[model samples]
Target: MSLWALAWTLVFVATAMGLSMWRRLGLEKDMLIAAVRATVQLMAIGYVLKFVFRVDHAALTSAMVLLMSAVAADNASRRGQRLAGRFWRVWMAVMSTEIVTLGFLLASRVIPFQPAYVIPISGMIIGNAMVASALFLNRLRGEAQARRDEMMVLLTLGATPRQASRHVVKAAVKASMIPTIDSTKTMGLVQLPGMMTGQIIAGADPIQAVRYQLLIVFALIASAAFTTMVLGALTYGRLFNEYLQPVV
Candidate 1:
């Protein structure tokens, strides 16, 4: 946790870059860039979070959460370049999912509405939703391309665009959600999740940590499902043209 200890962590990044070079993988530059970006971004967020935690105002906390969600949506939207209006589609999906999940939790008093609790939990929710959105976009595009002929045939047979692409949409949503479901199933048995591990390391009770982890895991499942479903619905329509032909 000291500067000296943090500096030692760079050895891992150096080793990764060295391995990439030794293997002729042509990824040394990318590895270096990623390492530097991670360091700078984390340090910057650390300071910002320190300030937020100190101020602890509801308006500032809401603004921070909205900013995080916007950034996440932007990052995920890159994967859906083929889709029209990809950014707003992703932004709406992520924003709706975050609002519904966090709103419910806060209204129900399942979690406190303070910066210390809301900000971290919002990060996890928004982050997972971002990943889910990326996965949905990737799978949807791949499936649509692979099934282009079948989709065309269905359209020729007078099937509605939605009906023709139903299978692809469902499959993409399912594929996107599978990882979240699998990780939750294997939780403590496969890995100690970061939230729980951090709490335990910070001297919290194991039982308390377990409870918090469960809450997060459940929230994540909801987040993934909502993100995938909303994104799939929003994006599938964009894949068709005015003539009901597949465009993607």
Candidate 2:
């Protein structure tokens, strides 16, 4: 698409701002800021990706993927700010997910180890894992607060912290994973994923696009599950103090 064509797409943003104003929702500023930031960020990434794809160096590609994973973990860790070592917990979960999913694809010879393929696929995996991590952390915080009494009772009954927080951790993990599971269930019928849609729009064959989309679908589900589970395991222990009483 041309610059003019891309500029015309701002109509949707204008429409959103207009609706916010009409409803007196007080979201016009936030909407406008988001729109501006999204435009600028996408343009910046587009250029960076162009350069990376041209260079196609292994070290640079690996650095780019690591940077993306780090950023994602940092963002997700905010949800667990009250927990100690939240950043590292999130980073480990995200990195593990990236390593496992991407490793499998590369080992199976499904996609080349080039920046053009790895970077984009890694972005999606990291993004999904980030969301899953954030969701799990947020839900775990809420569960800990809401179930403080129950956990305390369990603790008083001589249960370990892990056992006492088992229900809460399980609930949080399930809650975090539900969105990915539901989206996968309704995938093609409900919506064409962005990657698949973009590929088709770029004149790729529909079958090839679908194949790539399926690969992404599987990777995303695995990413969500692994990240949430790992994050839950790492985080649940922090809920208790040295005396084994509930702290979180």
Candidate with the greatest TM-score versus the true structure:
2
- Tens digits of per-residue lDDT for model 2, 1-248: 89999899999999999999999999999999998999899999999999999998999999999999999989999997789999999999999999999999999999999999999999999999999999999999999999999998999999988899999999999999999999999999999999999999999999999999999999999999999999888999999989998887
How far is each candidate from the true structure, as Cα RMSD in Å?
2.0, 1.7
Candidate 2 clashing pairs? none
lDDT of 1 by residue, 177-237 (tens): 9999999999999999999999999999999999999999999999999999999888888
TM-scores for the candidates: 0.91, 0.93
Please report, as a residue range, the 10-residue window in candidate 1 with the lowest summed lDDT.
80-89
Off by over 4 Å in 2: 18-26
CA-lDDT, candidates in order: 0.93, 0.95
- Where is model 1 more than 4 Å wrong at Cα? 14-32
TM-score of 2: 0.93
Instruction: Give the range of the ten consecutive residues with the poorest summed lDDT in model 2.
Output: 73-82
Report the CA-based lDDT of candidate 2 relative to the real structure.
0.95
- In angstroms, the error of model 2 at 12 is 3.0
CA error at residue 83 for candidate 1, angstroms: 0.6
